[model samples]
Target: MFYRIITLKTTKEIWQTKRSESNRILGIVNNVRLFGTNFSNSRIFQKLLVIITERFETTISSLENINDLSTIILAELLNAL
Candidate 1:
């Protein structure tokens, strides 16, 4: 049986411990760009998606450096309400 692993405490920990390392967006884009489409029918890829997605969940978020994110989005996200 296939089991999906997920936990809020663990999610919180990774978000706090690692944020910049997260690359969910890049993976998704790569999956689309390279393979033309490679998300569905791929459990391994799905797991990767979840792993990095959890990075977005955090009690606190910060942008130590600005990248492609717009100023408005960065400001709203870094100083979340």
Candidate 2:
């Protein structure tokens, strides 16, 4: 999510707007910091690596079946043409 408020340079208005903008930027920085910390602690990358490895092994084991299916489809397409 993104938000922006454009304000012309005025005496008091500029000061107030600047303060709000500074606060908003600080809030975003803090949120990103927290998210990075949590992501590291969760070890999500390791879990994803395990899942991808298992899926890849499964695919490799089934390559013969996949090849046969692709060959059948290609022959059918050529016949249609």
Against the true structure, whose lDDT is highest?
2
Residue 12 accuracy (lDDT) in model 1: 68
TM-score for model 1? 0.22
Tens-place lDDT per residue, model 2, 14-70, is 556556644654464456467766544123322322433342454434443444432
Specify the poorest-scoring 10-residue window by lDDT in model 2.
Answer: 72-81
List TM-scores for all candidates, in order. 0.22, 0.32
| lDDT, candidate 1, 1-81, per-residue tens | 001224435666656533433343345545665865544433433343345444344422332133223333422433331
Q: After superposition, which runs of candidate 2 have C-alpha atoms over 4 Å from their true positions?
A: 1-10, 36-81
| TM-score for predicted model 2 compared with the true structure | 0.32
- Against the reference, the lDDT scores of all candidates come to 0.38, 0.39
- Winning model by TM-score: 2
